[model samples]
Target chain A: MKLYEHEALGSIFKKYKIPVPRYVFSAEMNDAVRQFVDKEPGVVIKSMVLVGKRGKAGAVKVVSDKSQVEKVFSDLATREVYGERSIGALVEEKLDIEKEFYLSVTYSTKDRAPAIIFSEHGGMDVEEIDPKLIHTYIVSDVRSVYPYQIRQFLAGIGFSDKELLRPLSEVIVNVYNAFWGSESRLLEINPLVVARSGDKRKIVAADAVVILDDDASVNPAVVYGARSAQGRPLTQREQDAILIDQGDHRGKAGSYVELDGDIAMMTFGGGGSTVTAETAIEAGLRIANLTDIGGNPPAEKMYRISRIILSKPGLKGVLVCGGTASNTRIDVTLGEGLAKALDDMNAEGKLDKNLVWVVRRSGPEYVKGLKMLHECFVRNGIRGEIYDSQLPITEAPIRLKELLIKLVGYKPEEVV
Target chain B: MKGTVYLNDKTGIVVIGATGREASQVIKESETLYPGIIKAGITPGKGGSSELPVPVFDTLKEAVSDPKVGKLLNTALIYVPPVSVLDAVMECLDNGIKVLYIITEHVPIRDSEVIYQEKVRRGAIIVGGTSLGCFVPSVGRIGAIGGKDPTVAFRDGGIVVISKSGGLTVTTAEMFKRRGWGTYMALAIGGDIISNTTYADVLQEIKGDPRVKGVVMLGEPGGSYEEQVAGLIMSGGFDKPVAAFISGRFQERMPEGVAFGHAGAIVERGMGKATDKIARLEAAGKKYPVKVAFYYHDLVKTIESLGVPRDFEDSTTEHVKPLYSTF
Candidate 1:
């Protein structure tokens, strides 16, 4: 649910009346960029990405000459920042920096309240900043935080200049307003600069890092459009997987993220799925995708996700794993739901016979569930292993690897 | 709030979204565990209809005002949609329902914040946004935790099990069952960033409860709940020995902000790391009988190392047999 810089500045920040330097973002240089360049005295070209510290990644550049604008935009847009391809390039008016400060609005788990974090020293990443220097103000009210309140805190934190205090406090309030108005889980403005606007000094948000609440009642996807958690475009399988739980709270069978490995995983429960995926990776089983399925989803709910999991191309292995369930009926989720999916795929000749499969699940009616799944494996001649809770949850990966090594000549860098 | 979560003669229950599939299913399963606790159901405009085996009321107010239902009901289980949670919670608070167990996940953070403010202002006990349920063996259960018959995994002994995830809560209990032990209480506090009911809150409420001897906590890699629990154990309220398991340790190697399974399980700004949280627990362990386990499966052995006394009982109930008859 993270928003790109352009997305935030164009809509949310402006809606909150936070001063943002005029900017234009595009995949390629266009007339808008040329007009924007003609108006601003100085321009900063930044790579539009979800990850922070784009400056450190050499994705940001200063265009001193107008002739270099298109080349810089192309360079920033084409480059990958921290392993993710740049979505586009953002061109903004570079401010004449008088000073910089740090500000953000996010939830503080310790206080169970919305916290506005402020620091006089900016431009440094949050981790590098001295924890003591950062002042935290817990706001019980999510509706608003008044400017005078921030003004008092700013003066207490050594803001002696009365002229700068009011405007800066208003800016801070606007930032909080943006965060609260947009229902953002996190909105950080690093290096919020006190810039010289002709003869007057103005406060402006130099950079924005926004991660919207995905679970918000407002459906962030409607505003931000649909996206994968990894800041990439959604694959067809991922799109289908997300639609499984839309407006349906029966049980969550959705939460799917595509990875670059060869194993298609149908893991259940949040904690169970994470533990299984970590073990699978440690055991050197490349995961093609990851999913967290649980909460006693109906048989049909499981049927759809199961089909999506098995429909992925180039998957050499399939791992169905989870901890012992509390209430999720294995007979429904697996015995009936997944069994039917496998039958359908097999009938359509979409099922891959050469792929190795391993399942380690236990819970209510798991015996019937595993028995039904085993019949599918038998009928399709799929080679793999199936285990219940007798096998250690962490050991499911090693068991899959063992079967893979024996049956498919899978090799691990280290001796097992 | 001492026995509010536990089902007893004084406990009165109402299902907010009783007509919903999940809510009705929980009502059915919970009735088998303990009937009469769930006195009524509330789904607007469904009044005078008997769908979930309980009398349906149009609103929480109407249900709370009934002579047969209102006088006894003190707790509510909410299963409404994410957007309607704020209103549902407010109604519960206004109606004097002391205990609320919310089974809905994906509740907006702002809504959770408002709920927290009001819950504090009113001094009401609230649990979960994505919580599985609360359980007290031989007493009753709330939400869909511990399955239809929790006795299959849970038996009243002397232990208290607290976990961030419902699956891990049951897994911990089942593991203890293998070694012939059970829990006095096992509940999921939910893994949302803003947890209305946290480990510390539960520990505070359960302070000096005689049925609880020790506690085994299953933690994840996000939120400061585990750290707060460590602080509470170090303080005077939690005198009993505790064992903790913080899962997702490998997240230390991944990118900082990558989302783990839980919404609150992401590591941001070098905070909420499993190693850091474990370090805090280990620090508290020096002053308290806190045992830390790194791996998920290592929790049982870690808790057993505490050497606390257990009220040994024949945990072998008839429930476990039929469920595992396939084996």
Candidate 2:
């Protein structure tokens, strides 16, 4: 099962009956730091972004006095540690602890049933601990988790007394309830801290990681701050693309991606793009973008996607490669678009001698398109190379690599 | 001499509804790669004018009669809707263009089966009843509506890709791109159970190819094909390392065997459990050892682990070159 980071999963646990320490999320580190210093001098300042092992990543910090709070918050929030967008830090009150415990409930892929795992010893890497100490019970039915079932499972983990067992069992039951309700792939509570005897102690979850099954479509708001399984906030572009793909809005075929590379590669088939990218990479060339030219679409739609790929500032080249399998033809739009771009570049005097334009067009209408492309380049005197071959995809990269090395002086031997 | 060839004496790609925009795309892509592309001379009453540059006659015979026309690429990429795919694929196959790559989708499965059997008799390569069609990178791509993107998609790498799902093949490619481990070739033959070609065919192709150093197979729950392929590897012929990750583990948690997306995703007693496939492969590894390879065991270490004996481990970066090095 995949693991979810603190803010996303911890938020879920604090919603269900699981006892977790009080916490607050804020966009401003200054405000969060001020609140922590004023309310509790000793508190944990954690980066609220989605990432694992923040404690090790130095995203997590602990401050004892009021003065250190600002320094810790700024340090944790300023740097971009993982790929997640900076959302500031989560400040929370430190739970008073005497001892720690471990517990988890998850659906077993092998057994085809829900399983509960519990341990008296917790916190320090639950996975590294003895698998035997983490007592496990597979339950096919949810209703089977009665008071006695919880006792049986807890007793297996060395809890014999009813007094300590009663409240712990209730916590275990509610946890499973929340887990099942959330349809979580995994619910891990590392070091469910148990309070000391005779002082009114409570078991609080020290850490939580919950991987929710997206297919369940259980609203994230219901569970509180649970991000999608991808473990990152949905970029507007990505969300928009998903929406368009699922609906009939676009009606045209296209795939898009925003990357650091300059060249925007929008090819016909999935197979062709893979080969082209691999070839470019192997040749010590970089692909600034990747996209699919999708099946039959109106010319307008095709132009729109081509424009998007070309819109990238660094995009210096475009590769239009497709396979020839029986029927189908490479459209003139592929040629027309490249020609249009070249005309723009020439008019703007932006066309570089080193700029590479390669097109491997196949299928029925290929002859006309290839001829059209050749005429356009020749008439314009724009530099490029085109190959009409019956070779497998593996050979295309070699050709591209050879052209790049010969024309651009790129080292062909270096592995990308 | 043993290199894979996209076109052969028996392979001649045909375009149905040759005048339509969809058919035009098929004609353009196919003919550009394969020079001797013979379009199916069919356009109902308007057979007088050539569809694009290709000769068009009133009947399939007139199309095949061209001296340049070799064996018919029987499988037609029907640009027409569901109503026309049945007649189109049937006519092409009946006239002996056995290998049909139907680009059109949503055609009733029953109609697909009828054409499927007829093509089987003729020994035609009927790729899609409902398919994204297929692509062979630089060599040639068939039924690919998207012109050039696929040329770059199936770039040169060592992973032999076999997928039951069509779009999932795209996801697999993305993974390869992310890991910087390109692929030798990936065949997404579509999810039709009576698929035109089986994983066995693709695996056999990979086994015979010297360039494929490793095989990365993507299998979902259902069908005994995974078992069949696993058994084929057990015969010790597949010298390349096989690395795979089986999805549909979530499906096993369901009540019983239920068909998922692919026709082959059925969980019978001996079929379609991700763990079971893993177990079978593990067991096969014990007996045959060299034939079965797993992908999860570190991408770097996979070559050494996949039955390529220790003495022969090519430690140099020379063997580590991209799969398309020879290309």
Candidate 3:
């Protein structure tokens, strides 16, 4: 789940015509913030970070005087909330709150459906509020969340006034539509404030937290363009990996996270790689990085990944493992790709002679691939052990550790 | 009996998007293993031309309407892109295709939901949206699951290897193969967010098969599929001596909501943690004689202890020899 920050969510709400206060998002007290505050004397300043509970963290403040806006924004900008520095501060026109309601649409794993949770009491913690006051409805389908159902749900939660229910139901329907349309996992509007401006009253979302489903193919434009899952920015290595993945159309290749460890590891398949990583960690091995190579990528792609994994500093050993081969040829991944990469590194005198390598693979041409990899290791004078499909997938990491102990006299740490 | 299991030897097959690279390669390889099984190929606007013995038709309806191809199209192997998978699946379901192997990845979740709902309504079985497809050793192979060589990881046996990860399917099968055991069938159910078929669903069908004396399941964290399988076992629906391996234990230590590998392999709000799956499956195993393998090697050992058949050793050598020549 990738969460859109306050400014992004506010923009989305505005685009959908859901009521929200006019806001300016900026890193500093720029022209936009100046103009936004000039129009409204009273403004609410919020640190634009993905983490919640900003009010409790002192990341949000209500500034009644225009002179206090810059100081509040600057103070919030310098402080890190929940370990994430504020990307910017959302300066918005403060509303005259008459009442507050809470509305959220999210998928319920237990019900296996989209659920809408609404409460009359909104701005504060919904969890602490009386459970009886909260109304929950699990929509069988997003398309089938009818106005009658919404009205009934609202009425049950003490929203009985016809005029109030009329606009509330419309907001409910639109919120549901937006949730479903965006394929969002969670769309929460806390403090769905009923504001009074002179004689007119309107319901507006004061704060929004929208987490789009990572599986959904959301429009890049709507998502504020190529957002990172880390909620900040991509590292140089991650960016390079993404570029390599984009460079090829042939098998799937990407996902590289650098860690502080000596052993560089790459595993194949989704579940298999995680299991391998866990097993390595269990055996007192700290992983330098994690790379998933599957879909039978060509030799060149494998070569690139192997190069990247090897390039990481403090690499004592390299473990390349995966589950049984389905369509991806084991020979291509190891023999033609990784083995070649290792050979090239060896020729350049970049590879340490004592650096242990463990290759465990299954699938097509297991014997031949293992043979090629074995020969390459011998030729490069790189100490390594190779296992075929016969060995269980999880055993490779332990075996690598044992080999590291025997060959390099490396002592296993008691980290469990 | 809940849904059709179209992996048997008698079931005929068709290759949708047959002219595509992956489809054509798998078709050619499958012919060597299970000859005469692939009856028809469908590629829009590429009809009249033949992909060797299998005839190419413009649409599924065109192929199903032909007298020679009508009766031999029970299974449809879809090789269309992710965007077109839902339509391709609907076409197969409409044409009375009992089983669909959706061999595409990155299919939108909304589209997967529609495909899943339609499959249930029609009492049909779907293998995957990102699946490597299924391989029934000696019967036939669908998709490119077994690689260019099927014999490396597969052989005729009593164990049924069902996995969310396609790569693990081969690994589990090979584990049995090395132990002088063979699988009754290996189903790569695909590690997608919305799998058309779940482990429990497959377990229900495999439980009835007399040939399948035991089962090997390879599961990953994310979703409740493993929990559901545990439920089925606890409820006495699955009677076989099951050896299960659930991966992604390391994900629990990582930050929540970061996808480890597959899109489906994610731990959210601590719901689908690997430790939880292991505990649930282990608790259920205590009541129903289930064996949970924390490591892949443990799974291999558990299967080895379950006395089935040791006739695979001779066949393994013979089958593996032919594979060397293919390269």
| DockQ ranking from best candidate downward | 1, 3, 2
Best by lDDT: 1
Q: Per-model C-alpha lDDT, please?
A: 0.82, 0.55, 0.77
Instruction: Report the error of model 1 at residue A314, Å.
Output: 4.7
Worst 10 residues of 2 chain A by lDDT: A242-251
**Fnat, 2 decimals, each candidate:** 0.54, 0.00, 0.47
Who wins the TM-score comparison? Answer: 1
Which DockQ value does candidate 3 get? 0.38
* lDDT tens readout by residue for model 2, B193-271: 3455666666675576666666666565554456666778777656456666555553454334233343344454334
- Tell me how many clashing residue pairs each candidate has: 0, 81, 1
Answer with 2 or 3, whichever has the higher DockQ. 3
lDDT per residue for candidate 3 within B73-188, as digits (tens), equals 89899988666888899899988898888888767776776676677668888888778888777577777887877777777877888888887787777767877788778888
Of candidate 1 chain B, the 10-residue stretch with the lowest lDDT total is B318-327
lDDT (10s digit) by residue, model 2, range A180-200: 766564577777887653578
TM-score each candidate: 0.94, 0.52, 0.89
Considering only chain A, what is the TM-score of each predicted structure?
0.92, 0.67, 0.89
Sorted by lDDT (best first), the order is 1, 3, 2
* lDDT value, residue A69 of candidate 1: 83
